[model samples]
Target: MKIQNKKTCIAVLILVTIEQVIKIVINNNFLDKKFPILPGFLYFEPMFNRDYSWFNSMFQLGVSKWIHIVFGAIMIILVYLFYQYLNYQFGTIKIVNIMYAFIFSGAMCSLIDKIFWNGSLDYILVNGFFTFDLKDVYINIFSGLIILSVLLKNKVLNQIDDNIVKDFTKYILRKL
Candidate 1:
């Protein structure tokens, strides 16, 4: 692996390790206990969910817990494949690599929870919205970062291409 790749791996490992540690603590200490935070907007409570964060309604679509485990495993593999693809195709972009690391690490964290524990360990509760764990937070934020990095990359590339076209046009006009 290149230096950037190594750094990305290390960063992901550190983040995953931290997330798991926090999850273990929450699981052991505060399972199903709610501690209010930010009045009503946020709260800390450890709970388990067998389904993916965004799949509450679809979870009842005849998907069993064993199937969820299988899905989690498949997701982990897909995340790894996507990261490898990005590395091979766009190795020059460090931010993209880092974002991929975040995404993979987050997915791995959830997979670990799904396989070893009862379900995905969720704690952070948002009033009138949803509940999530650190792993979920990691996945959500890093996924957003991945999208942002791609958009920024495209914008930068477009600007550079536009500048090149303008410069060529100026050169042609001067020659004429």
Candidate 2:
């Protein structure tokens, strides 16, 4: 890897570190109650999820951790392959770099939660229709941004229509 590649890795590492730091701060500072800024708008509170059983709750804690590790490894490998493909095709580091940042940020966030706090921490509730936390917001927004970026970057436009061209030629012949 070149210098830029090393820098990119460092950037992703920084993102992971920042995520862990945020988690630590939240877990250590606030454990009492929710801090409601708006009455029905938003609330900040610390919530812990001990069981890492989103779909299945039967398995033990060790099993849950293994599930995450296996999933994370697979996911990281896929991301790496996709990133290489994108970078090679486009000859630009923009998309891959953005993807790296988001993927690492998400991975570190969830990984730390599972390792330290048992499950994931549910904090920073959103008001109005539903409730959410910082981790949820980060994950959702990051995913949306990635999808939008990929769509915009790889969008195909100015497609030639053979039928339209043929029809135009026939119309000109009739006019002549």
Candidate 3:
């Protein structure tokens, strides 16, 4: 299960590196201009969402200018927990190594923006959701893949009945 595969490792490193570079550029060039990729649809508008934006959705939370920090804290905590579980469960699996890289980089990217800019990037817009950047995309995709992997693994294994799985469960139950 150890990932000694040079090709896969290098590719994932390249992806994480690229994501960091994009984040740097976006943070720097934010005030320059809003690059619209598609009229009335998608545009690269670099700005912070501020803690106020999310808080305004439901609760008053005091002032309109300041949004609640609860959302940000929750997101950061969730990302951290996800990282811990993934590392513990599949640290040696290379196919999952890519997913891990994506999650780590994306979470870091958002954390950076939130810390300094008070929000994450909103680069591409369509309706309510913004593409933000590739890092954000990586976060979503990798999270989905992780969930899918767990679901698929369980579903495939559940095909066996208790009698059929007796051999496998013997050692597992013994460990219990």
Q: List the candidates' TM-scores in order.
A: 0.76, 0.66, 0.53
Pairs of colliding residues, candidate 2: none
* Alpha-carbon runs more than 4 Å astray in model 2: 1-4, 53-63, 128-133, 150-176
Could you tell me how far off, in angstroms, the CA of residue 79 lies in candidate 2 after the best superposition?
A: 1.4
Each candidate: how many clashes? 0, 0, 2
User: Native-vs-model 1 lDDT?
Assistant: 0.69
Report the C-alpha displacement of residue 134, candidate 3, in angstroms: 3.0
Q: In model 2, where is the ten-residue run with the lowest total lDDT? A: 154-163
Candidate 1 residues lying further than 4 Å off, grouped into runs, are: 1-4, 56-59, 153-176
lDDT per residue (tens digit) for residues 1-176 in model 1: 23347788888889899988988787777776788898779988667776644574345664666776788778776566545544444454676666667777878887787677757777888987877877777777887875775777764333344455466445446535
Candidate 3 RMSD computed on C-alpha atoms after optimal superposition onto the true structure: 7.6
> For candidate 1, what is the TM-score?
0.76
- Model 3, 1-176: lDDT tens digits are 23344554465567767766765787776655777677777777766555434344236454433223445456655554544444443344554566666775565555555555555555666646544567668778887886776777743334435663454445335535
Quote model 2's TM-score: 0.66
Better of 1 and 3 by TM-score: 1
Query: Which scores greater on lDDT, model 1 or model 2?
Result: 1
Estimate the overall C-alpha local distance difference test score of candidate 3: 0.56
